[model samples]
Target: MTSAALSFRYVGDSGMDETMNQQLLIDNGLPNSLAPVLSFKALDETHHVLPDVKVSTVFGSDRGNLVVPYGGSYDILRFSGPGKHDVTDVRVTVQRKTEARNPAGSHDVTTQALDSHGRAIEKFERFSAVRLINEDNFPVFVRIAYILWDQPPKGVTQQAVEVTPIGGLTSVPAHGTAVVKVSGKAAAAVARNSYGPAVSIKAYNSQ
Candidate 1:
């Protein structure tokens, strides 16, 4: 309902503390029990989003050509409004993760944006990166899953149509990067002064 910030509740491995180890929750007023929250800016015209979504996480290496990690859940946050007038559809591009290198036993994640449908919006060709899994271990390729949902008012139709590539790891065996683009559509049938639901992101790893 027109929140100043947004957050997520991730449910998976990743080795995160159960006590909401997030910035939005700490900065905002989110509780500790519900962890992995993603905080958004403010509510707007395109804010109305749906629930129950999925995202994909692909891990690569900067030196060889792959990335591997233990696993973990990730979340997302927005900082904009949905708008004033009710509309038909809205599209967005997000850049989750960058030219980062991961070490063994630990995890580092980047931020990815989502459309009204909660799909991983891309900003590059392929959301790819490279990192060292362990000190002596070679690089490994990995992939993760993500979920996106719609915000409030309810009874709204939201869908994730496409995921396009924006940027990727060009310099192989040296350093690599990844980027993705996601698009969605929404049917806003009502118009009035009301706040939408809260936006959240959650991620976890497999055993």
Candidate 2:
């Protein structure tokens, strides 16, 4: 922990989860300015990068709190992205099959689509999430958690999915990749972030 480690959440799946009774614990030592991008992978003792066990990154920002469990290093790439900044923490969120969700935190904006002129053209309300589909012959279990918010989507119908997280750089065994769904728009009311975008969009004017 560093000098900036004052604010963080700690609500474990605490008693509801099992103890991995393993050696080599992994701790999050990043400064408050940065957080783990997404979950991580853990391999088996054989040191076989191709085939091994897996452990997920920490749970929600409320839970695990950036610190990982018995396994290798955390996945910094998932937490840090090109366009994403000013994030406290990040985690992979999934729900029951086929239900579009909302952004759990302020950082959970679905990546907006851009036209030739680099303009956003989304109609319905959009939220970002990580979706994983199994395309392999065997069943693969992934460890993931809900978004930063404990509250369910205000008016959407959905259920949570239980996954088995993996540690190490690679996942245990799965034929899939992380497909993110996030979106962001200028908050007209906020003077700092939206002044430029809102002006061009004609949504609001400082004059």
Candidate 3:
């Protein structure tokens, strides 16, 4: 912990006057111009190249995961596209099985048409979202994360998936390739629960 300390200096005319001026300055609790300086730097190549961090609003997806004792309730939803263009306009659609009986009451489909990159493109004209569909009547929890790699190697890490958003989407430069994956749990608690297992979207903005 750091604390401020009282400092005195010679001020004004002669011995007595200088002593009094110094005392006055000290008593006033004034800050000294000569203070310690603090600074920092990027540790390595990775941190240095990354861009500022930003967050995006959560959205829904159609991807579904199987429920088993050890298998888990979440499944992997993959998104692949050309890294050459800025990826946007995602729409999540959740479709429940049509039993031809309970029509309206059997589905819980919500829409967030708002684009993730609204500020960059004004007028709300540019919009994107993902789609979500429930095939086995199981509500799925999908969380997507991303990362940007300038020259990603053609191997496991290149196409690896994670439960958390990977890479730096906000910091992802133009034409840079990024691998984003979703991971979460999904299960219907009540047998009569119509909305299925509710899933929440958590988005991080990487500026």
TM-score of each predicted structure versus truth: 0.22, 0.19, 0.18
Model 1, position 199, has a per-residue lDDT of: 23
Best-to-worst ranking by TM-score? 1, 2, 3
Go through the candidates in order and give the C-alpha RMSD of each one to the true structure. 16.8, 20.3, 28.1
What are the per-residue Cα lDDT tens digits for candidate 1 across 26-110?
A: 1222221111212222222455543222222222111122322323223222222233123222222221222225322223323
Quote the positional error of residue 178 for candidate 1 in Å. Answer: 0.5
Best by lDDT: 1
> Model 3: per-residue lDDT, tens digit, 40-68?
11111232311221112111112111111
Candidate 2 residues 31-145, lDDT tens each? Answer: 2222222333232234233222233332332222332211212221112233222222222322111111110111111223233344454312221333434344332333332
Better of 1 and 3 by lDDT: 1
lDDT of 1 at 9: 32
C-alpha-based local distance difference test score of model 1: 0.25
Q: Is candidate 1 or candidate 2 better by TM-score?
A: 1
Candidates 1 and 2 compared: the better one by lDDT is 1
Q: How far does residue 114 in candidate 3 sit from its true spot (Å)?
A: 10
Question: Would you give me the overall lDDT of model 2?
Answer: 0.24
